[model samples]
Target chain A: MSTSSTPPAPPPSNRISGTAISKEIRAELAVECSSIKSTVTPGLAVILVGSRPDSLAYVRMKKKACAEVGIDSFGYDYPETVTQQELIDKVNELNADPKVHGILVQLPLPNHIVENLVTSAVHPDKDVDGLHPLNCAKLVTAQTHGGSVKMNWKDLKSIPFHIACTPQGCIELLDRSGVEIEGKRAVVIGRSNLVGMPVSLLLNHRNATITIVHSRTIDAQSVVRTADIVIAAVGRAKMVKSDWLKEGAVVIDVGINSVDAPDTKKGYRLVGDVDFDECEGKCEKITPVPGGVGPMTIAMLLRNTVNSAKRVCGI
Target chain B: MSTSSTPPAPPPSNRISGTAISKEIRAELAVECSSIKSTVTPGLAVILVGSRPDSLAYVRMKKKACAEVGIDSFGYDYPETVTQQELIDKVNELNADPKVHGILVQLPLPNHIVENLVTSAVHPDKDVDGLHPLNCAKLVTAQTHGGSVKMNWKDLKSIPFHIACTPQGCIELLDRSGVEIEGKRAVVIGRSNLVGMPVSLLLNHRNATITIVHSRTIDAQSVVRTADIVIAAVGRAKMVKSDWLKEGAVVIDVGINSVDAPDTKKGYRLVGDVDFDECEGKCEKITPVPGGVGPMTIAMLLRNTVNSAKRVCGI
Candidate 1:
């Protein structure tokens, strides 16, 4: 027994540094982009079916991010009167064009065009947003292609890009904040196939013990109270109250809701799904609304577009 | 004051009769099968890789069930030393075989073959057990496809029967016993996709409020204690103690566990996942292991096979 003996176990530390982790991952992605062929500009297509100002603002930020990452973007500003068949035809046209690698129809469509038709029409391989039924299937099951009946171990890398952007952002946020996903207890408060389901699958793949709570889950709040990591994405404004949060738990709030706020000059204030006022002292780390999961969603959209282009071109 | 007659709210009755419900379903299936062409035989290719005495006995029972139900059964008995490649080859051969409408490889294959591999190879349309990745995807996203294409809705009749055997059996047991599934609080223990996942999906579709719990879930035992209906599918011996069960909660034990019972002549005895001794006075309805989900599994399997043949021939 010498001075080189192992040190004693240190006291636990409380910190949530998700911002740094996300920044580092972004930096790594930026480096990877630069290392690849610099002149290959990734192309993204955004089809808007209406004049929803909110959708426009979201699309504008995404286009700006594309510029930042050397990706070219195109947008189709269609009137609200567009028919479902017309929108589907446009998506089909984009799907056939070799120049267009990704197709995204800004959601909240004019209610005429069935969203399912638009989602299904996009080629699965080119589905960057991962909303296609086929893509969703692929994300859950590691099965191989329509070309091969057998699942090749290597085929996993070819999984379609653009899973639920908010969930993808949540994963990045957790990793950046130094939260351990492996074998940790994670509870997601929602069951939408979009974010809750995909995020749960991703977390399950990473070996984190996961539980999904829906409206039917009786006393689901009590379940959330025990989670090491709690993801509030129920779309309900501050439904996950402060009491439900486990002490020092890393929180990833994926909901961007705007409640009535006449006090602000803008007439409305942005708030995440979590009650920020109650969570400040209890949570280890939390993302602020407007700058948190929102930005990450746009960033991931660009990333998925680039990824889809790379796979198609065999880059 | 008008002396108008008021309708009485139905009293909470212990009406979920599990045994009677199962019998009712079997009888109903018999009527449905008889009304159709009796000559319609759903052909099943049963691939047995090993010679486990218990497994062999199960196979014989399945063959007997098929015969009882007017199903055409073909048994492929492979040696314990069968290679994974050989198994895969056999499955492909059967998949292409026109006569074989459904395929089932007896589970717990010898050490050489990966169970997930052989099981997944069974064509989704012909997959009676609903274990194929395609079916799994369909279940998750509510899409229908027998294979790697847009499967026609007509193909559904020919597709492997949607045999919610055990879960369906639970419904049968309840119906026979006069239990109501609609508008009841249901708690499912275990989250295995094969049982818990599908059952929860079925229950959700039926409008019964459901809460699904698994190993990752916190206080699973406590959650079960409050349920009106509890489904124990976790393959743990005596895991769900009677104390955790709600008063008069209908319990469907899906576990088949073998525990030491030197007291019995066979040197060991069969036991369900639940402690029936403790459940004697507590549970309103309970299914024993040997006669419970076991028989229903074979019954549903045969039903699936017959339906498969019907769809294949467009009957």
Candidate 2:
């Protein structure tokens, strides 16, 4: 089978291309953009406090994706030597900016500064990443109890974007690969709000009886195997093997781990948490790393930013 | 071994109890109380809307428990005809009064008034039952992100008292029963915050691997069977049979279920979610219904109320 016309992995562990879905979304957004000439392009302010190569790369990818989707990117690059108050001030500036619809400080902030305080500084409406405490309160408890948004974005309270994006990407992959999610058993290996918990909510909303297995969980492998869908986000490489999977279970590997893949020229290759080689024949569907959920996450962020602006602007 | 030792079951499933452990907890709390003055009692205000029989029974039980614990009980029985605004006003009045340390409204309000409005009205410090949204925010995602005073407290934010009571009971049961919670395969058979969710958090805090399986979960029996410690909160009659349990698993059944007992006077017997008949000689330790978690829950409510008063009064 030629690489160009190989029918894109439908034979075994079929991974649906995120590019296709993202393209459709971009087209819709473009139509929306075209309809309104005086369009308010949603502005995202990303605060990078440290010089971690990975975090910078991730931020860069996000900015590039934002540009592709018609969202404006505002970068706030600060040195590690900066004090907590200064960082908080920068967040406050972004929070007050009428045009700024989103603010995200990359993880692993300086130890001296309180990350939560700074993150909370961004108004909930501009919390496109939805990492704010208010957003989390809504997610874990009930959406109805969401802390008051400073703006008129009534809809932002309901759309838990940051966590929802990753979960949505996982679902999109499965759906596009022809995997059945409704009324099927699904096990999410991890319970952090960013990935596991929200995925469980989405899966539950979609009618999949979901089990959330965390580091504090027992018989996690057995739980994962029973699921028609298995989403492993536990960062550990190859933690989920074929033997632990039920045959034909749709696997959505959310962990973008870079293990010692010295065989490749980049010194290390991108590998998912799942043992992809072993999983291909065992599962009916699986999302690949680098090209799978990675692309989808950034695309979703842009979509969220646009929506956030629209809701707050009442446009 | 004898029927006299095993008291009658109640509700949807047998709520597993530690007759031995409850005795131990009482003894310990008694010891703790011996040092503390009885005059400085925690005040619990029970406010009920309407005359639902179940709600009435719950309030009565709470009042009775408060009496036993040397706590003052202020009962306010309101009518079903109360408007949402009037209820809010009443709750605000309770919120402002220093005399009222803890306020509990019997749940399933007349469907006309917003449940969230009434619940969120209680102040967090005075929310001894711990169901307030702000308090729940404190539990799930602590403010300032990584600060980690991160207490899951007595309950899920919904019926804060509901979870706070169950969590306190579970913690007490485990301690008295001598079950090591750390690194245990703890399977919580329900996803509710009142018992299961908070229990999961408590177990996680204590360093246990946690798996939450519910009705939509593929094989709940298999999941439950693998736990080092099993907590059954699903209100199903004998849903967790002996075979579903591992040989030496510590069982905590939180369900108070009533099933058809043709020989009993009420035409049914009360039981825990676990089958007591099957649990005997199996688990190293287990709690019995009627006297187990049920009493412990009441005890904890009294304790939390006292604790809430200490915080609210700055004593």
Number of the top-ranking candidate, with TM-score as the measure:
2
DockQ winner: 2
How well does model 1 score by local distance difference test? 0.70
How many Å off is the CA of B260 in candidate 1? 2.9
Candidate 1 on B7-80: residue-level lDDT in tens? 77875544343344445545655666566655555688999977999889988988876766556789999999
TM-score of 2: 0.81
> How well does candidate 1 score on lDDT at residue A144?
42
The DockQ for candidate 2, computed on C-alphas, is: 0.34
- Every model's DockQ, to 2 decimals? 0.14, 0.34
Give the TM-scores of the predictions, in the order they appear.
Answer: 0.75, 0.81
